[model samples]
Target: MDRTQYLQQFVDETGWYNSIVLGLILPEWIWRPLPFPLQSWLRNYIGGSLLYLVSGFLWCFYIYYLKRNAYIPKDSIPSYRAMKLQIIVAMKAMPWYSALPTLSEYMVESGWSKCFSTISEVGWPMYMVYLLTYLVLCEFGIYWMHRELHDIKPLYKHLHATHHIYNKQNTLSPFAGLAFHPLDGILQAIPHVICLFVIPTHFMTHVILLFCEAIWTANIHDCIHGKVWPVMGAGYHTIHHTTYRHNYGHYTIWMDWLFGTLRDPEDNYKKGE
Candidate 1:
């Protein structure tokens, strides 16, 4: 059998739509009684806020309290005051961050974006291709958007600088992940929406990827090196926080390496000594 035939066979065997329906059940239930546009915005805000709070708390509890000795040094643990400030900033930005997804969903519903409802619409082969393309586009867009937030003085001073307050290990934590100015957080996420217009995307997959940002950011801000190659793990992000001159890539270090701004975690350790 050829590639297309093999993909068709695979798709036939996998009931992917069932998983998508399962994921949407809760959101649809919550949205049932709410009005249309308001429901879109309100649901996203509430869901995003809850995800941030729960993920941030669990990660902080596990790493900072449960595995404190294994992950963070005694002096390097972020203070309660710092974590509180991070939470406050993140909560303030949550509503604004939620708007992007609401708007994106509107666009998708109105047939503005090339977002498809099912994998079979494009066939499994093209589904995989589009998915990969969407991710790459998002990665590329985020890298440049993030880099500009630092290179452009006004943008950094007014927007991105809020996140840089946690410039040291002791000041960083899971809570610090979303501690960006409202506009800054939205700006970084605009890429995900942009990709919807650029190519075909599975609606549910796109939504899941957007939500994954919350988990990814929390993980990256934990200040513990996971030592995963190419991934923009906490080790690399820590260098970005301190030096502010390197590793602006999101999701991965490929963009940083390609654009000549990549810095390894060991470099920061050497400089500190």
Candidate 2:
């Protein structure tokens, strides 16, 4: 069959992209008063900040307060001072983090990226392929960006070290997710934006995936094993915080395994016992 004919089977009028942007990204009443770029940036900053605060607070409370006794040892819970510092650092970096998306939106609107407004434009099969490709590229980019943040002394000492301060279980929490020097956080997140240029992605899917980083980071810092193979769970991330030389992959452990930096939680447990 011809390419057009094959793709025609997957076409469906799902106005998902417009709906998401109107309902979530640019709420009409709230952002209508502002001008082009300002409205975009403001919406991004407010949305990002709210996502970070709400997700971090609720997750931290669930694990640290509601399930403290059952979830973690009392002494292992992060100190209030540590969590407070994490929140302060994250809030300070959030505006800068929001700028990346603002810039990305501009790039997409300017036709610099291969971003499609809806899945039907690329067809379901091709869209799924593009989504998977975007994720793989992101994993690869983040893995190296994270690793180099440690390998390069100036980068680590000046930028990444802010995050490494919470290097112990007792010093780490969901609040520690976005707690990085602004540049450091942005550098790591650049992968998501970079993928847009390299692959054909659904615009709304890309935006949702970008924001999902906040939730994913929080999950990885919670110190729960999760035991889902190939996924870089909190157990793997906890090791990264302490060891500083392994498990630098984001979203998945495939990069770490490929690069010979993968350290399993079971191995750590065996050593401890």
Candidate 3:
């Protein structure tokens, strides 16, 4: 083979220049079992995780394209300093959270652990119900969470203030909670996390759950303004940040109306619109 052919073969084998933006690297990070006997369990779990990673990578590119087009704004976003602080805070809290005792403790501790445990305990068939159940729960859970943080005096000054710093919601900021107070990321992520433990299922559901989270959330941050109906895609959340105290669900529009938190009920929400 010529030099060019040889070089091409090396690159193909190495996956060099393989790039996925905002893609999850969690699978690569999974803790593999040791001593050569029990590693198969990890391989199975890791395979599912890798599937999530691939979907997440594509979603990242979609968001990046949107960001560049100004469909999502990239300006007035977090500074590196703020981003680093947000990450550091989350890292410090994860270990403390995983080791905590009791479901209630999880609730009081990290939002991530609390939710994940909830879903896990619900067990199989009931776990299948989690997506529907959580979709319902999150509307009130997050809306109220967001509103209370802003309206309650102590919470406003202490927790929710940092996230409100964003001037626009057009860009897909994975670090939306980057500099979040340790308590804040949990508040944001845990609701869904707790739902994870509340129900149980096999690997496929786990994979689906991961993708649902990344894609849906990216769309939430994709709109220029919180447009209602047909554009449910970004409007609700945009409205939340724009006005505060209204429109609080991530996946469904029903809870907002039920709770009177719905900003515009007559608005016809159309998908991919």
Candidate 4:
């Protein structure tokens, strides 16, 4: 099959998956019983923050407590204690930072959600197009925002620099993923917010996307040396942290490769490889 055909299939399958999990399953078993505000976007934003902590801790525990290895050669700079502290600060700050975007969807339009009923009523091909278009736009925004963070010195020093503290070898942990300064976090996240306003996105799809994003961020910081073909993975991100000049794109390497920032992971030293 051609690239377009392949993408369509992938989007259709994932849309169905999101409809079931985020729409039907979550509302029935998880969100419905929540108390008042807890059942709203407040729940999603707060839960997303908590999800960050839980996912980060699991990765950190595995690397620092279990495996005791990093994808890149271990360097000494930020200590585990420092990493822990940054995670605490970032987690506390994330809810407020995430809220701005989530809340702004109302300003754009209503009835944009892909709830179970909506998904069931809509055609998969149409749903696929919406999902694909939304993600591509968001990814484009993420690429530029991430690249600018590294390119602009003032921005780097004031906002993005805190994130690079983990650039030093084993100094990175899952917690190091969200260790971003609040401004940096917001800038990187603006794309998702913009998507909600510009694209016809479903509430459940948006929630699931954000949740997966948190997990993906933590996984990259863990530096597991796994690659997912065209998709950038922990190995891709580890290169960005270690080399400090390549792989600036998130989710996919297409942007980085197109812009001449992509680096081969084989060039980097991985533990026991």
Q: Write the per-residue lDDT of candidate 1 for residues 199-228, one digit (tens) a residue.
A: 999888988899899999999999999988
lDDT of 4 by residue, 1-273 (tens): 554553344345434443443464355566546543333445455566667777776766666656554533445334768777877767776766656544543332233422322465467887788789888988889999998998899999998988887765567667777778888887897887778657666545765686677777877776676767888887889789877889988888888888898886876654432
Model 3, 162-253: lDDT tens per residue?
Answer: 66664354322444423345476457555544555554223234334533554555456544344455334556666666667777666666
RMSD of each: 6.0, 4.9, 13.2, 8.1
Report the Cα lDDT for residue 26, model 2. 63
- Model 4 residue runs over 4 Å out of place are 1-42, 68-79, 108-117, 269-273
Q: Name the lDDT value of residue 99 in candidate 4.
A: 61
Candidates in order, TM-scores: namely: 0.88, 0.89, 0.51, 0.74
- Which sequence of candidate numbers ranks them by TM-score, best first? 2, 1, 4, 3
Clashes of 3: 28
Instruction: Candidate 4: count the clashes.
Output: 3
Model 1 clash count equals 0
Worst 10 residues of 3 by lDDT: 14-23
Error of 2 at 212 (Å): 0.2
By lDDT: ranked, best first: 2, 1, 4, 3
Alpha carbon lDDT of each predicted model: 0.84, 0.85, 0.46, 0.68
lDDT digits (tens) for residues 1-273 of candidate 2: 664443332222112322344457566786556566666677678778888999988988898888876877888898889999999999999989989987887777666787776677779999999999999999999999999999999999999999999988899899899999999999999999999889998877887898999999988998877999879999999999999999999999999999999999999989992
Model 1 quality (TM-score): 0.88
